[model samples]
Target: MKPVFFIAFLFFSISSIVAQPTQKPLLHGKNWMAITGKPLAATAGAAIFQKGGNAVDAACAMLAATCTMWDVLSWGGETQALIYNPKTKKVIAINAMGVAPTGATVDFFKKKGYSFPPEYGPLAATTPGTPGGICLMLANYGTKSLKEVLEPAMQLAAGYPIEAQTANSIERNKTRIKEWPYSRKTFLTRPGEKREAPEAGEIFIQKDLLTTLNKMVEAEQQALQQKKGRKDAIMAAYDRFYKGDIAQEFVRGCQEQGGLITLQDLANWKPIEEEALQTNYKGIDVYKMQSWTQGPSLLQALNILENFDLKKMGYNSSQYIHTVYQAMNLSFADRDFYYGDPYMPPVEPIKGLLSKDYAKQRAALINPNQNDPAMGPGDPYPFENKTNTYLELLKKRSFSTDSSDRQFMPTHDIRTGNSFNTSTDELYQDRLWRGTTSVEAADKDGWVVSITPSGGWLPACIAGNTGVGMSQRMQSFVLDEIINPFNVVAPGKRPRVTLTPSLALKGGKPFLSFAVQGGDTQEQNLLQFFLNMVEFDMTVQQATEAANFNSNQLWLSLGGTKMEDRKPRTGSILLNDNTKEATRSELKKMGYTLSFDDRTSGPINAIYFDWKHGSLWGGSSNHGEDYGIGW
Candidate 1:
C-alpha cells in the first residue's frame, strides 16, 4: 500500500471507532435568564422578567405556571425556596412545607382503629403552605402584584396542550382519582365529557382549577377596591384560600371524609421566612433550609468531606464515589436520627452538627476498604445536653405501620385491598403511590431566586369543589417514632421534608442559583455539580452533563420505615452508561452494587452569573419537559 493512502485509511478507522460526545445547548444571556422543568413555565417566567419584574416576580410566575403544565406539581401542594438578595447580600430560606393538622396525634389514628396514619386521602393531608408562601414572597420581595405575576399561570390553567409525560401520569393515577368523587369529576372528566386519560397534544382545559385561581384573583381585586395596598391585596388573596370560602370548603371536605383537618388549622397557618443554614466549603458558601428538611444533610456531608482533597480523588473515581457515599451515609444516618422540626419538643441544637470539630469526628468513621452497612446516629447533642437521651425523646410519638422501600408515599398493598374505609384505618391498603418543578431567575440588579414547587396532582385527593388539594407530606412524619426526634409527628408541627432548594455565593457575591427535584438524591447531585465547577474547573453546562450517580445505601427520607430496615444497603450505585466501563466494573468489585441503566435524571436547573462579564450562563438537565430560557 502507498504510504499516504495507508495513513488516510488508519485515520478513518480510528475516527469510525470513536463515538461523538452528545452535548446539550447551553443558554446564554446578559439582561435576564430563567430555567424550569417545563418550557411553558420558563417562557411565562421570562415574560414576567421582560415586563419589568425582578427575580422573585419571575419565580412566582414560573411556579404557578409549572402547576398548570405538570401533573406532578400543583398549586395545592407545598413549596420551598431560597432567594438571594443582592442589596442585602443575604440568602433567605422559605419553609413552606405544610404542617400536620392541629388534631393530628398518635392517638388520633389509634382511635380510628388503625396503627398509623394512611398515606392518602384526607387523613394524610396537611394544611397546604404553597399559596401562603407564594403570596408572602410576592408581598415581601417581588415588585409586581399577585394578580400580575399570576396572570400567565391563570391563563395556562384555563387551557393548554397536554404533553405526553403528564398524560402518562394521569393514565396511571386514573384509578386513584376515581376513588375520590371530587378528584374524579375535576381531573378524569370534563363538562359532559369523559375519557380514560388525556391524550398528548390535546387541548387540556382545567375549568375547575381556573375557577379556583380566579377566586384568589377576585379576592386580591376586592382588597384593592377596599383601598388596600398591593401587599395587603396579596395577603387578602392568600386569606381567600386559608380563611375565606375556600378554607370552609377545604375543611368541610376533610370532615365529610373523616379526615382530621379543621377550620382553625387553615385560619392559623402561615408560611414562615427563616434564616438559612450555611457552611463554607472551598471558598463558596452553600446555603440551605434548616433542620426541618434534609437540607442540613448536605451541609453535614460537605463538612465531613471538606477535610479531604476531593479534586485529588478525581471525579466519580472509585475512591471519590466511595468517600462521598460514606460521608453521605454518615450524614443521612444523623439526619434520620436527629433532624426534625425545631419548634417541636425535644429539639436538638444544630450548632453541634455543623461545627468543624464535629465534622472531623464524623469523617473519621469512613472505612476505606468497604461500605459500612450500618452507621448509627452521631452524638450531635451539644456539650450542655450531653446527657440527653435522644432516643427517649423520640419515644414520645411512637406508633407502628407497614414499612416499604418506596421513597415518598406508600405503595398499594394488594394484601389489604382498596377501600376508603378509614373506620378500620386500612384506607390506604392496596393503594400504591409514588411521587420538583424548579424555576430560577436572576435580574441585572443582583436579585436571584431558586424555587422548587411540588405536590397536588392526580394521585392527590382533591378537596370537594374547592379545586384545591392537600399534600401528602404527612407521610414524611414517622408513624412509629424512632431515634429521630425531629421527625416525630406532632399537632401543628411541620414534617421534616425532602423538598430542599439551594443557593450559593462566591466572594460574598451572588454566584450560583440552582436546585433539583430528586427527593433525597437532590443534595448528592447538587454537590457533584458544584464540585465540577469549583474543583474541576468545568463550565456550568459541562458540570451539569457530567456523569451522575445515586446511592440508595441510606434509609429513604420521604417515607416511614422500621429501624431494622433503615440500615444502609451494600451501597447500591446507579450510574449512566456514559460512565467508563472500566470504572463501573472496578466499583462493582469493591463490593458496591452497580447498575448501568438510564433513568429519568432529575433536571438540575441552574444559572451562573459572571458579574465581571455581565454574562449569565444557564443549564437544564432537559429531563422530560425541562427547558432553559434567557434574554
Candidate 2:
C-alpha cells in the first residue's frame, strides 16, 4: 500500500476498535450560570450567581479572581465585553481597550533613538482598562453592589489553597516570576521550599489585591454618600483608583523604575463604545467585538465555510482539515493586511470580505492537492495590490525551527552590535501574543455587554512585581498600513488584536455568550467551536472537546530569521478500537498532519439556555486547569 493509504488505514482501524462515549458531564441549575478559564475564577462568578446576581455581576467577580490567579492577566490589562439583554434582545459591544498615553508617539520613540520597547516595559504599556471595563458593565447592567461582587474574590485571595493548575502555571512562568520582587515574594518562598498549590477545596488568598478591592469599595461608599447614582458612584470609585492616591503612588513607582505612564494617561482614558460586528451562520445570528481584536476574522472564516459542504467532507477527514486550513489562511491574510482601529485609515474592507459574493469568489481559489505557497485576499477591490504585498511579507516571515540553520551566523553578528537599532529592529519584528476575550449577554432587562482585554508580548522583565509586567500591544498598529495587522505598529494607532468575545441571539432571545483566547488561534478556534455546535449538532462540551485544527500560515512575520513555505497543520481526532482501516486510509490520502491526545483541543466555558428543559446548561473545557471549576 502507498504511504498515505497506510496511514489512512491505520487511522480508520484504530477508530473502529474503540468508540469513545459521547455523553459527558454537564452543568445544570436554576437562576444564573457562569464559566471561566480557572476553577477558582469560575467559583468567584458562580458565587455571585448564587447570590442572585446576573451575568454582569458574575463577570465582575470572575474578573477580580482571575486577576489574582493569573497575575499576567490582571486588572491593569485592557478589556472588551459583549452583553446581551434577554428582554431587549439587543447586543452591545463595550470596548475597554487601554489607550496609548497622550505622551506616546512614534516620533517620541524615534527621537529617543528607541524603536518600540518590549511589551512588558512602561513604554509599551497602555492605560489600564479592567477597572474601567468592570465599572462600565456594572453601571449599565448589573444589580449587585460592587462590594457584593468583589467580596468573594477578596475572601478567596485572602487565603485560598493553591491549586495544581495555578501551581503549574506558576512553574511554567517561574523564570518570568523570579524577576519580580512582589511575585517572587508571593509565589515562591526561600529557594528550597516545596512548591505549594491550593488543593481542591482549599482557599487561596491575595491580600495585596484584596486591599486594592477594599479601597475601591471605600471610594464607592464615599461617592454614594455624596448622593451619586449607582453608576456614577462606580465611576467615581474607579476614578479614585486611577487618578487619586493609589494612581499617584502607582505612577510614582513606575516613574522611579523607568516606566512611562503619566497622570494624564490615566485621567483622560475612556472606554470606546462601538457597534458589534454581526453575521448569520446556518440561520444562527453570530456577533463579535469589532476592530481592535480579530472578531471579524471569525465572521470571515464562517463566510468562507458557508461556501463549502463541510458535512459532506466528514469531520476530521483530511479534506475537511485542508478546507478549513485554506479558509483560515485566506481570512488571516486579510486580517494581517486590513483589520485595525477603525479610527485609522486604510481599513480592511470587512464588508467586502464578508459578502457572500466575495466569499464564493475566494472559495473558488482553494486547491486540494497541493499547498498554495501564498494565499491572497480575492480582489475586485482596488486595494488588492497593497494587501497582497502585506500577505507576501507575512508568508516570508513565518517561523520555523528548520530555518534556524539558514542564518545562524548573521543573527549572531547582528546581536553583537552595540546600538539598540539592530536589537529593536529584530526583536520588534518577531513577537507572538495571545489575548483574553470576556463577554456578557442577557435577553431581558435591556442590557448587552462584551469586552476583549489584551496585553502584548514580553516588554522589560521587572525584577519582582509580576503585576507590573509591561504590554507591547501597541505594536499591533502601524502607520499608512492596514488599520489592524497581526503585528500592528503605527503612529497614534492601537494594535490589532485576537481577543474578540462574541454574543449570539436566536429567535430574538439571548442564546450564547462565548470567547476564545489564543493569539492568532482565537478566531479559528471560535469559528470551529461555533460550527461544531450549529452545523454538526454537537453539545457545547462536544463542540469544545472535538478535535480542533488550524493553519499557522499568517504567523510567518514573527518567524524572525526562520521562515518557511509550508505551515504547520495541527488537529486532534478521536479514534476508538472499533474503526475500520479503510476509512483512515482515505483520510490520509487527502493530506492531513496528525496527532492524538486524550484531551479537549481548546478551553471554552459556556452557559447555554435550554428552553425545552427550562434550565441553563453550563459546560467547561477539560483541556487544562486553565478551564474547569474546582469548587
Candidate 3:
C-alpha cells in the first residue's frame, strides 16, 4: 500500500468555502496556552503563563487546580506525562503511576479465599504517586516553586462551587463514601449527613484537603528556610506526603480500614522518569509510555494498520471502522496476553510489537470481508531479546478458556455515561480510573507537556486527616498466575495502568501533545485523533470534535476474566451520533455489535504547535472535560 505523502496538488484545488468554514475557528494565540478538562484548571494555567511561566509550569498549575475537581481527579492520584523539551529537543515520558505494596501478593489473596485481590480498599490502594509526579516536573522543568503551582488548587479547594461532572461522580459513589468517616466528612454534603452529591453550582468546600495542600506548601517553606535549593525544597514537599507525617497517617488509616499498605511502602515509593516508547509512523514520530500502560497498544495498532489504505477507505466508512477496529482488537489481545511491567524479568520487547515486519504479519491477518471476532495474540517472542514468560507458558495455559462465570462487575450508575455499564464483561472493571482527567500546555519557547492525573475518590478509604485518598489501581492486576505477565502481581511492580498522555513529532519538532480521561479507551481515542490529524489533515479542533469509534473486542477482560461467554456479544464497538448512519448499518452487517452515543470517549484535550505560523491552537470538546484558553 502506498502512503499519502503531502498531496499539495489536491489541497490547492479545494474551493475557498471548503477551505475555511463560517464557524468560529480554533482558539489561537501567539503566547502560551492550555487545554484542560475543567475551566478553572485551564484558567489557572493561563494565569501561570501570564505570570511568565512556561508550559511545564502551566501544566503543574493546571494539574494542581484540577485536584479540586475531586470527582475527576484528586490530591491522592496517579499521573503519567509525556513532555517535549525544546532545549534538548527531546521527548520524555514520566511514570508517576504507583506500585503494588510489598504486602500485596497473589498468594495473600488466594489464602484469604478471595477470587481476586481487593478492589475498593487499602489493600487495592497503591502508594499515591501524583504528588511526587507533579512535584518532580516542577522541580526539574518548571520555573515556579511547588507552592506557586499549587496556589490555585489550594484556593479552589478551600471553597469552590461543585460542577456537574464532579457532583454526578459524588452521587454515584456515595454509598461507599459513607463507609469511610474521613471520606464522608470531606466529600459529602455535610459532616455526618447522607445527602447526595451537591447540585451543580453548589458551593463545595474541602477544608481538610485545603489544609493538606497548605501543609505541603508549609513543608516547602520550611525547606527553603533551611537553606535548601529549589529542587531540594520541592523534594521536601514531596517527602511531606510520602516519607513524613502524612505517610504515617496514611499507614494508620489503612490499618484502621483493614488495608495492607505499610510505612515502608509509602517511604520507598518514588515516581520513575524514563524515555518514552516511540515509533516512526509515516514520518511522524509517535510516543507513548512503556509496557506499564496500554500506551503501546496505539503504536502496535498504528503499525498493523500502516499496511492498509485508511484514507482511501473513506473516514467513518464501514470499511474504515472495520479495518481499524479489527487492528485494535489484535493489539488489545496482545496487550492482555503479553504486555506487562518492563521492570519484570523477561517479556516481549515493545520494539517487536511496533516493528514493521511484525505489522506485516499482524496486518496480513486482517480480513476485509468479515470481522475476526475472536482474534487472539500473535507470537512476538521470536522478536524478543530473551525468553518471554508469556510465550513460554502459552501452550500450557488455555488461551481460549472462558472464565465468564467469574466476571467482575462494579455497580455504577448508567446515567453517568460510564463505558463499563455499556459492555457485558464490565470493560469498566479494568481499573478504578473512572475519574481520570487530562490537561495540555505549550509555550512559545517550545516547552510542551501532556499530563493525566487521576485517583483520589471516596469509594476507597482516605488517609486520615491528611486528606489523601488511596489509589485502587491495584484492581487492574490479575490474580491468576498464568495470565498476562505485565499484569501479574509482584512486589514493587507498577500495575499496568491506562493513564497515558501522548506527544507526537514532525520533522523532529514537537507537532502535538494530547491526552484524554478514560480507562481502556484512552489509547484508542488518542490513536483515532492522531490519525485524524495526519491522515485526514484535520485541524486539532476538527480532530478533537470528530466522532470517536472505539472497540474493546478482545476476549480477555481486566482482572483476568474471560469475555467469551458473551460471544456474538463478546466484543462491542462504540460510535458517536455524528457517525454516518450508512457506516453504522454497514458495521452491523459486518457481524459487529455496536452502541450509539454522542460521547464515545472521555473529553479529549489537545494542543497543536505550529512552527510555520509560530502560533498555538488549542481545542476542547463541547462537554465533558472541555475547557481551553490561550493568550
Q: Write the per-residue lDDT of candidate 2 for residues 199-283, one digit (tens) a residue.
A: 4344555555666677888998888899988888887878887888667755765565555678777787777666788988777
Can you write out model 1's per-residue Cα lDDT over 82-185, one digit (the tens) per residue? 99987788998887878899778877766776444556778778888888889999999999988899899888877888775566566667877778877777
Model 2, residue 381: C-alpha shift (Å)? 4.0
Instruction: Score candidate 2 by lDDT.
Output: 0.58
Q: Write the per-residue lDDT of candidate 3 for residues 1-631, one digit (tens) a residue.
A: 1244434433442222134441225878798878886778888998899889999999988888876666445776788898899999999888888888877888987788665556676777877888989889998999998888898888898788886556656766778888887787776774445656677689888776788798889999999999999999999988988888878877887779777778898788788889898888899888999988888899999999889988766666788889988888888878876777787755556777877788789999988978876687787756755455565566665544321332211222111233455344322332333345688999888898998777665465787877777777776777775556657787788877777899999998988888876666777889998887787777887777677786756532333322243222234677777677787778878877676665554467788888888898887754444588988
Total clashing pairs in model 2: 87
Instruction: Report the Cα RMSD per candidate.
Output: 7.5, 8.6, 4.9
lDDT of each: 0.74, 0.58, 0.74
lDDT of 3 at 562: 26
TM-score, per-candidate, Cα-based? 0.88, 0.78, 0.89
Best model per TM-score: 3
Worst lDDT window (10 residues) for model 3? 406-415
